[model samples]
Target: MNIPGPEPRSDGGVGAVAAAGGLHTYQLRLHAEYGPVVRFQLPGVETAVSVADPVLLEATAHIDKRPESLFAFLAPLFETGNLQVMPAGEHTPWRRLLLSVLAGRPSHERHFTQFTALATALADRWAERAGRQPVELQKDLTELSLRMICAYALGGDTADPGGIVAAFEEVLTEYLGRLYEVPDGGGREERTRRAEEALAHLRATVDRVVLAHHRGSHPDKSDLIGALVEAGERPARIRDTVMVAMLAAHHTTGVAVSWTLHLLGRHPEVAERVADELDRVLGDRPVPEYADLRRLTYLEMALKESMRLYPPGPYGARETTVALALGDYEIPAGATIFYPFWAVHMNPDYWPEPGTFMPERFTPEEAAKRPRLAYIPFGLGPRSCEGAALAMAEAQLVLAVLLKRFRFRPAPEHEVTPTERFVLWADDIRMTVSPRRTGEEAR
Candidate 1:
């Protein structure tokens, strides 16, 4: 099949589509301007059409089955045997351990106190810096999220959130930047080296924590590391489990927090409603419990809506290993198919007024009307994010706590746009935070 016209941009801007010879740009522009499914091709690659088509999505369940499509892109950060890279069955044990830690009452109870403490600490910090001071919620939330993960997962906070995060950020930035620049052999090798260096640093940190737990010499340890170490037996599994846990827990939460804040700032009415929801449900409190997450329905809906708009893992790909039938086209073995959620989420056919920041779109009644797979922020079918439930619970708790304490707006004259690499986040968002009190509290 010969696909014609428009290709992925070679210049590689953030949010750029992945195709050859301007195919990504074509798909991005055409999906908005024309219809869902568009034909595109990359130079030196086979002619392949990218589908934001809902009908096509239904026809292809094998999309994420191959690791090479999405996981290969991440190979620089994590090795082939890592949980994210392994075949479905092989990854289950690690997933089970993570699920056991992140799910259930004990984990929730342990995490609730930590989440509240971190949220309170953050709120207090912002309140102290009150007035017209510009506070970067993204940075603050990133720190808070990483800290929570470190404290909860790695025992106490040994991982420097800012420092380690910067190292990983550098790898992602450099690699993604050079990815589209002619695929130079030497450049790719250098990028791979840097990635390995960053991963080695992080892995070493995890190893040290595991070793401390093994030796029974660490104190003040109340996080996931302690929980796993205390479980007894299976030392190697425990180490791999924690490594997977950290990767799963930290980055995704940061992205979710960033997007939640970005959406709240973009939509004042939504933020106000969220605040009201918080007031009605949870009044000023020292900390909130896991059960409290259920009461804040509107806030949860807003998070759902936000995730729908900007799923941190926006684009997922899978390489084909066998001939598959997809709609009218026969997808050959070894072909790569890209699934861009950004395009899928914004498709008007699936979501009316897709670009608008309307939280009500996720209301119970409205939600039941859409296709099951239509709003897959955490992804779909099997292999969906194992921590989806936990992440939502944590996000709701944090959002409630923050909305209750302060009010924020999008930074003036600062355009916040999605910058895509591994996760989608606001490029430059400078927002001022002010303590909110209902007149009587102003004094």
Candidate 2:
């Protein structure tokens, strides 16, 4: 079967999509021009296919192996093995273990108090700054998310939370910068040396955290690190797991919360509705409990809608381990299958007025009508995000605390642009915060 795609550029299709517009936007254009199964060019890969249609995606949903060539850039960050490149035999058990800790209701409840307190502390800071300076949504939220993950996953033994967060950011910025650069660049050697230094700093920090856990500095046996230590996992494997968890936990939730706030800021009516729900649910309380999460239906719907429009990690990819048939096209083994999540969410058939920010789109009645895979912000099938439940809990609780305390409005003359750098991030989501008037304040 023949596949439709644009002519490959002579530059080896390096930065082709990115040059057009960001990768996310370029993908929407691809599906618009060509059909759902559009062939595309990716640097360092032989053949790449982008599947936009949800129906077609089911065919390849079962393939769990990620493309090694694509994920190899992350290998240097790990010691024993790269979780991204783990084969099915190892990946299955590893993922299952992660699910046991991350997906459990008990685990979420265990960490809820610390998570809520951290979120409330940030909200309190924002309340103090209301009407003074615009809040940096992504920066603050990323730090909050990082702190929560460290507390939950590594326990409270971390002596310097700020230093650990800084090291992780340095490693990400250095490696991600090099990953996008042309391989034969002039300053490649210098950049590579800097990346190595960053990696060393991150590894040393992780080593200290792990050693503290083993020495009983953190006695919570149920914590993620403690559980692994009790399971007798290797030190290298434990380090890799912790690093990966930090990498996954930090920015994704931060960006998700950032985008949700951005959307709510633009639509004051929706923000008002969310605020109303929080007021009715929590009443005089500043923070939301685990049980309160289920009662905040409007907040949950708005978050789901936000993810549909601006998924934090905009794309997911897998290498075909065996011959696969998708729609009418036959994808050979060893081919790169790209899942353009942003494009999938924007598919018109699944979502009407996909560009419009309508929280009602996610209401239970409305959602039941659409295809299950139509809304895949966290992905689908076996390799889906294990910490998805945890992320939503964090995002919803933070949104509740922040929104109930202050209203967010887009900062004057500061434009928010979504750029892809391992995650869909807005460097500056500049928004003004004004304290919300409650019953007591109004009286």
Rate residue 240 of model 1 by lDDT.
56
For residues 1-443, write the lDDT of model 1, one tens digit per residue. 43333445554322334422233234557566546655544443453445676667776653445544344444455443455657667656645655676665666666677778878888899888777577877777766776666666666556575556655555555556655454565666776677668767766776777788778766645456666666662555555555555556665776787677878877888888887777676666634567777788888888888888878777665556677677656777777666667777787877998878888898899988877667777765445676777677777777777778888877678777666545666655667787776435654
Every model's Cα RMSD, please? 4.6, 2.2
* Worst-scoring 10-residue span by lDDT in model 1: 12-21
Top candidate, metric lDDT:
2
Instruction: Return the TM-score for each candidate structure.
Output: 0.81, 0.95
| Model 1 spans with C-alpha error above 4 angstroms | 1-27, 42-49, 62-64, 67-70, 79-82, 103-105, 157-201, 215-245
Error of 2 at 264 (Å): 0.4
Highest-TM-score candidate: 2
